[model samples]
Target: MENQQQTWIDLAIAAMDKAYVPYSNFPVGACLVSKSGKVYQGLNIENASFGLTNCAERTAFFKAISEGEQEFQYLVIAGHTPDPISPCGACRQVMVEFCEPTMPVLLVGDEGALKETTVGELLPYSFNGKDL
Candidate 1:
């Protein structure tokens, strides 16, 4: 598991290098691992209107879903920040929609900093279809 996480982190960093950050200058990358061992990667895209921006996590999820991937095993997020950054509430909600509550989420920062958590742990009592 550690090795896999490291590999995914590396991939996420590589993807981050390709991000388009004109405003915030904070690039983020995300890697989604499918149950079938497929990896989908994405980078954050920032637009002039910050509200129109798309986060790296959502980019990866959208790509994977578009490719017909519904089930996922784990995810890795990489950024250039000092400490590893957790996904935003929107991203967390998206995870709750698609990923299992206990699915592993590895957060990696520059210089090899890393932290691990799960969707359920990140957002307890998340709102879902059952709550509606």
Candidate 2:
């Protein structure tokens, strides 16, 4: 992995430590880099109502978007799973909404393994604004 990617992965891991996972005990973290070079970190925030729980990827995206950072450069998601963590379907749809098709999406696993992919690759033929 490139130095920058490693740095993002480390940030995601650090963010994971802050996750609030009382129900599933599954913690996840995400780091989003904007086109302007701003970085946003997010951790899973679980709620008593399972349906209200938010994933780390959406948290990061919401944070960046609310802060007026629209164009994203990269995204890194970290988890303690055996393999590199993949985003949930909702998160993938959000990625398709806000991220460029070719934007890099990095997944980091418990052993620090890395899997690099793109927004489009994650959800091929996704429904978007164009489909409306």
Candidate 2 TM-score to native:
0.97
Deviation of model 2 at 1, angstroms? 8.7
- Give the poorly placed runs of model 2, Cα more than 4 Å off: none
TM-score of each: 0.96, 0.97
RMSD of candidate 1 to true structure, Å? 0.9
Expressed as tens digits, the lDDT of each residue in 1-132 for candidate 1 is 878877888889999989999898899999999999999998999988889999999999999999999899999999988898788999999999998999999998888888899989989999997888
lDDT of 2 at 2: 82
Clash number for each model = 0, 0
The Cα local distance difference test for each model comes to 0.92, 0.94
Candidate 1 regions exceeding 4 Å error are none
lDDT per residue for candidate 2 within 52-72, as digits (tens), equals: 999999999999999999999
Q: What are the candidates' C-alpha RMSDs?
A: 0.9, 1.0
